[model samples]
Target: MNHKVCVQLVVAAWITGVPAQIGVTYQIFCQNFCGSNKLNHIFCDSSTLLEIACGDTYQKEISLLVNTFFFVVIPFLLILISYFRIIATILKLPSTSGKSKAFFTCSSHLMVVCLFYGSVTIVYVRSKSSHSAKSNKVFALLYTIVSPVLNPMIYIA
Candidate 1:
């Protein structure tokens, strides 16, 4: 695809996300939280907030799950497939140095992708019964600290 098309696709993706974010955020905040306002996690993430909401969160959970599938899981799958193709191409490189360079770059990028999507999946995609709020907080904490630190180091290297 051309650069223009890629940029347009990215913008279009952002356009799609804006409504999901706003709609979810609006619905969550509109509710009177049943109990303590403070969440265990640092980030006031929507999923955690929904947990404390007074009324039925069935719609919110479904919306979150759908959004997670479309935004996080699908994109992660695409990245993994693209990386597999890249590794295959890299293995066919004639020179050892070229192969090593390609491998290093691809591995770093994959690590970042896994870290990001893994963190998100843990927090939002998992059934509330499957994980404790405290564990979610820990993962979210690690995700916020780890991904950004690694991004500059890995991508720039």
Candidate 2:
């Protein structure tokens, strides 16, 4: 079970990170040259590095697409499948105590999953929705700092 979970997480991180990294790298590089737009890191915009990555509308669209797929759809599908198998396994157990214990473990996992994904989704969505640099910084900071801090606490709880 531990191995499977580790594989799932590693795969999830790979899937989520790689494509977006390639796409963003290509977009930032190509667009700046291919369009001959001045690549100025001006103070008029970008309070955080995330804002710089998402400086343009096209970049923002790409980010939204990646986040929607990786953070929302893929995780939802994986979690659903895992939970289904867990339910089946627990049902096959002979004793009430075993099933209860399984469910308790699953519930904690579910809570942590919710906390991690929920904050990320909110950060991505909020970043996309708002035009303010300050709010974007706040969202970025929350995701970068608070989510990591909370994840372990959630697991411990």
Among the numbered candidates, top lDDT falls to 1
Q: What is the alpha-carbon lDDT of model 2 when measured against the actual structure?
A: 0.61
Return the lDDT, model 2, position 96. Answer: 100
lDDT per residue for candidate 2 within 48-123, as digits (tens), equals: 2334443355654566557567657687678978888989989999999989988887877776566556655654
In model 1, what are the clashing residue pairs, if there are any? none
Best by TM-score: 1
* Reference-based lDDT, each prediction: 0.85, 0.61
Task: Look at candidate 2 and give me any clashing residue pairs.
Answer: none
